[model samples]
Target: MNKNISAGWRDFHASAKVYYLWLALGWVEIRQRYSRSKIGPFWLTISMGILIAALGVVYGTLFKADLKSYLPLLAVGFVFWAFISTTISEGCNAFIAGSAYIRQMPLSRGIFVFQTIWRNIVILGHNFIIVIAVLAIFKINFLPGLAWFVLGFLLLVVNLFWMSALLAVVCARFRDLPQIITSALQVVFYITPILFKRDMLSKYPLLIDLNPFAHMIEIVRGPLLGEPVPAVSWLACTAMAVVGILICLAFHGRYRSRIPYWV
Candidate 1:
C-alpha cells in the first residue's frame, strides 16, 4: 500500500485534517460575514450587482467602451481584486486575530495562514456567482470550460496560500506592515487594468513591465478572456511560487514559535 501523501510527504489521513480545518474556517467566515446584514450573504451579491451597474455605466461611458465588453471585464476584475486585496489586508491581522489559538495550541502555524487565505477563497467563491449573474445581465458570453478556468483558479489559490503565510508572519512581527501593504495596493489599483484596459499599459510600457499586479491579474484573467496565458507568464508565476514558498517556509521555521507572543 502507498502511504506517502503528495503535499508534505506524509500519510493521507494525517493531511486530511487540514482539509477539514479549511472547511471549518470557511464556515466560520461565512457566519461572521452575515452576522450583521439582514440579507446575509445575499448582501454580497446585491451590492456587487448594484456596483457593477453603476460603475459599468460611469466607467464604460467615460472610456467610450461598450457595456458588453466593459461589464465582463469589471466583473472579473472585481472578483479577482476581492481575492487579492482581501488577502493582503486580512493577512496583516491573521495571526493577531487568532492569538488565543496560537498561544494555546501546538497547531500547525502554516494551517492558520492557509486558513486565512482559504476562508477568503470561500467568500470569493460565493462572489463568483455574482460575476456570472453580471455576465448574463450584460449579455456577455462567458466560457463554461471548467478545466481551464479551474486550473487558473487553483493556481491563484496556490499563490494566495504562499502569500498569506509570508504576509502573516511579517505583519505579526511588524505592526505598521499592514498600513504599508494598504498603501501599496492603492497605488497598484490605479495602474492595474481594473477600471481601464491594457491600453493603459500600452500608454506606459514601463509601468506594465514593472507592475507585478499586472502579471498577477493576467495569470487569472487571461484564461477568462479565452486566451490561455503565454507559457512565459505561467513559468514566471511558477518560479514566483517556488520563491514565495521558500520564504514562507523559512519564516515558518524561524518564527512560527514566536507568532503568538508577537501577536
Candidate 2:
C-alpha cells in the first residue's frame, strides 16, 4: 500500500515536472480541432453567446427577471458550468483516448488527465468572451471583488484536477462509466443554480447549501455577480479539494500500474 502511494505521488510529481509537454500538447489539440476553420475556437464563443441570449430571454421571462442583471448572471454561470462539465466528461476518456501514447512510451498517465482539463479550460476561455461581453453590456461592475475570482478559480481548478485524475483511472477500467457520468451531469445542471438564482429555492435551502457544485459555483459566480464571497462556499470548496486530492492520490497510486492493462 505504501509503495503504491509512493508510486502515485511520484507519477503526479513527474507529470508536474513535464508541465511544458502537456501545456503544448493541450494547445496543439485546440489548433488541430479547428484547423480548417477560419474563426477556429471563436466559433464556440459565438455559439455560447447565442445560447446565453436565448436562455437569458426565455428563462428571464419565465422567472420575470430583469434582462440587464439576468443576462450577465446567466452568461458567467453557463460558461463556468461548461468548463466543469466538459472537463469531467472528457477526463473519463483521458487514458483510453491516449492509449497509443500510453502503449508506445512510459509517460506519466496524469499528463493525459491534465491535457483533458487544459483543453477544456482553453474552450472555457473562448466561452468566457461571452461572459465579458455580457458584463460590459449590462454594466455589472464587480471589479472590487475581482481578486476573489482569482482565488475561487484556483480552488475550482484544484478540485477539478483531482476529480479528473480519479475519473480517468476509474473510467479506464470501466468503459460504461463515461456514459453514466454524462447522464448524471445533465441532472446536475438543473439542480445546480446555473439557470436560476439559489434564493429562488428559498424554501428548500439545503438543496443549494449542501450541494458541493453549488458551493463551487458560488465562490466564483458570486464574486462576478457583485455578491460578497460566501464564507461557507470557500470553506466547503477548500475542504472538498483537500479531501478529494488525498483520495485521488491513494486510489491512483494503488491502481496506477494497472491502468495500462485497462486501457
Query: Which lDDT tens digits does candidate 2 get at residues 1-263?
Result: 67776887899999988999999999998999999999999998888888888999999999999888788878888999999998889988999998999988999988998888888988988888887778887788879879999899999999999999999999999999999999999999998998998889989989898888899888899888888767989999999999898888889999988888998
Which ten-residue region of model 2 has the weakest summed lDDT? 1-10
**Number of clashes recorded per candidate:** 0, 0
lDDT of 1 by residue, 92-157 (tens): 788887788778877666666666777777778778887777667766454754566677677767
Q: Report how far residue 162 has shifted in candidate 2, in Å.
A: 0.5
Which has the greatest TM-score?
2
In order, what lDDT does every prediction score? 0.72, 0.89
Model 2: how far residue 95 lies from native, Å:
0.5
Residue 239, model 2: lDDT of 99
lDDT of 1: 0.72
List residue ranges in candidate 2 displaced over 4 A: 1-3
Q: After superposition, how far is residue 246 of candidate 2 from its true place, in Å?
A: 0.3
